[model samples]
Target: MRLLEAFRGTAIQLPNRIAMAPMTRGRADDTTGVPHPMTAEYYAQRASAGLIVSEGVWIDQAGKSGPGIPGLVTAQHAEAWRQVTEAVHEKGGRIFAQLWHAGRVAHPGVTGRTPVAPSAVRQAGRIFSAEGWTDTVEPRALGEEEVGEVVRDFAGAARRAVEAGFDGVELHGANGYLIQQFLAGNTNRREDRYGGSVAARLAFPLEVVAAVVEQVGAAKVALRISPGNPENDIVEDDGKEVYSRLLAELRRYELAYLHVIDTPDTEALSYLRPLWPGTLVANLRSEEPTSREEGELLIGSGLADVVAFGRLFIANPDLPTRFALDAPLARADHDVYYGARLDGYTDFPAFDPDPAKFACSARS
Candidate 1:
């Protein structure tokens, strides 16, 4: 099947076209923001994926979204992540760090820093924090100068990611995070150069891309965008104009790839696929476990160069093998989706076909 075929993308060559989607598994050190040692084994187990995007890693302390999320701000954090990258590399896998900043989505109770957005608007729902789930608050609006600092922070984080042994860095500009908060029409209500017209709203994300590319070369940089996604209470009225211009301008960088998230509400592929010429990583996002059929269709039809699977990767560490053999997939436990415990993390086993092979171990 095309899904299991080799990928010839310039960003990273692969034995197969199956890519592991970046999922926020709360298994890192909450205090130090370092990746847990088991993080290495967790990623290494799924090295068969064509490309693995590390979980959403915060760019700085102030940009932290919740407890247990990894960071790429300091030398210590880089050292810890180096182990993760090395482990993946040992298994012949290529991995990229997803540089993230939660922006208004960050709760002060979680990171001890006030959430900053393009505007002083409040999110209407509850968010995770130290005290558990709590009501979201009105975020502090970043001044023009402070916005420049955020851009610098992204560039700095990208440098740290390469030092951490990553093949590249994927800027988290999707899912209503910091970059999207600046790009989206509703959240960015400022009249400054950063937010006003189409160019203004696209300015922050474009600037972030440029800064990261400058830190690391364009080949070492990629971007993710979800134009029509409304997660985190985001509403985009002129998504077509915003994304059309954003993708058009992004052409200058000749980025490694463009990861796009598609949902029932958004026709991201129908509109975005034609705009991007580089490697296209398409994610058919859903809460349900991923099946080979979903990815096969995307790859067979040439809509996406690679398909990223999230929930399926949780239970099937040998997802590519199982896909090749048509093995029965395992169900993931939603309860343990986020936590430091390894119960629902690394405990998932590969698909074993020979029943007699484990007969003695099962009795023991």
Candidate 2:
């Protein structure tokens, strides 16, 4: 099966093309922003995945997005993540730390400071905090000098991730985060060298990538992007032009991989497939549940080198095994997905080899 074939990435080789996509579960320690012990167990339980991209890890206190999210800023945070990485590694799984900066999506109620973005604009949404849901505040426009500091922060975070025992780092440029805030035209209204046109807007994101590559080398870094996504109130009039320039510039870096979230029906996959010269990880979005069949088709057609499964991996820790056996997947519990306990985190059982026969035989 093409989906089960080995994939040689930039800095790591995977046993298969199935990757556990990064999903925010909000189960970290609220005060320290360290991942909970259960977090380590949770990831280790799913270590059979070819690659495990961790949840969005804040680079600094100022860039924190919400409560219960992990960070990579302090020695304590790194130490905590070391256990998680070690657990995965012991199981022969490769993991990547997804470096993130929330930008305007961060609520002052959560971070105790005003968020910063490319422009002083407030996205139309509410952010969850300890107090409850609070409206997103208008972010301060980052000064050109501050932009350099942000780039350094990302690079520093990448270094910290490696120290934390991660194989590499994935820059979270997708889903209208800080990098996407700079990429999307609606959120970025600055007239400086960092905004206005496509190339200008691409400046900060590309600079961030370059700084990260320089710090940790290109082979150890990956980038995630979602063009024309309306999430976080982002609107781009010309996604094709923006991504075209972005991808063309990115080709020179020869980074690890380009992770794009698009459905089979979207024009993004078609337009971006040829632009990127490196390995491509495609997260297919669909109204229905993602299936092994679809993943095989995506790999067989040469559209993606790796397929990432988010919700499925949540409910089925041994998802690849279940796919091999053609077993039914367990449904995820939405209510317990972000809870602090083990109900939905690590309590999901692996598939039984013979449910009916086992039950009858036990009774007999």
Each prediction's TM-score versus the true structure: 0.96, 0.95
- Candidate 1: clashing pairs of residues: none
Candidate with maximal lDDT: 1
Global CA lDDT of candidate 1, please? 0.89
| Candidate 2: RMSD to truth | 2.4
Candidate 2 lDDT at 69 equals: 90
Compose the digit string of candidate 1's lDDT tens values, residues 28-113.
Answer: 99999999989999999999998999999999788888889999988889999999999999999999999999999999898887
Worst 10 residues of 1 by lDDT: 355-364
Q: What's the number of clashes in each of the models?
A: 0, 0
Q: With candidate 1 superimposed using the best TM-score fit, by how many Å does residue 3's alpha carbon deviate from the native?
A: 0.9
Tell me the spans in candidate 2 whose CA falls farther than 4 Å from its real position. 355-364
Model 1 RMSD vs true structure: 2.5
